[model samples]
Target: MDEHGLVSREFTHRYVLPEDTLPRSVSSTLSPDGVLTITAPKKPSPSAPNERIVPIAVQGGPTPLPVQHEP
Candidate 1:
């Protein structure tokens, strides 16, 4: 009674959990179904200069400039 057919002790009690002797700057908090998300780490922006340009026959090679003819 497994394979998404449920009944493996009710999918291992809805999802096992009981291991993590903590100790590594310990810090945890998740209420999920009750809403409570937190994530941080973002601060680094200073290096600009890229006008973008790539048109060498659609980048399939050949094009040092020279393919113009307008009459």
Candidate 2:
């Protein structure tokens, strides 16, 4: 900071990660040029591989509702 104003503010900051949203595995690497890289492994699917989709279609028109007259 100077008489004019701040030339540049700090780019670094702290953050919090919720436990429920965290991945199983995480990796990080720092390059020689000051570049930081972070990666998280994808979680396994909840559904089984042999799972099948069952379509249940109800063939019927909308139920008629009693009409109400309003002034």
Per-model TM-score on C-alpha atoms: 0.18, 0.36
User: Which 10-residue window of candidate 2 scores lowest in summed lDDT?
Assistant: 15-24
lDDT of 1 by residue, 2-68 (tens): 7888753322223223243323333436594554443332334444686556675456667589879
Q: Tens-digit lDDT track for model 2 on 1-71? A: 78898565456765454443445466779797768787765555578888989998886898689999998
The regions of model 2 sitting more than 4 angstroms off are 1-24, 52-71
Inter-residue clash pairs, candidate 1 = none
The best candidate by lDDT is: 2
Compared with the true structure, all predictions reach lDDT values of 0.46, 0.68
TM match of model 2 to true structure: 0.36
**Highest TM-score among the candidates is held by which one?**
2
Shift of residue 1 alpha carbon in model 1, Å: 36
RMSD of each: 14.3, 11.2
lDDT value for model 2:
0.68
Q: After superposition, how far is residue 23 of candidate 1 from its true place, in Å?
A: 22
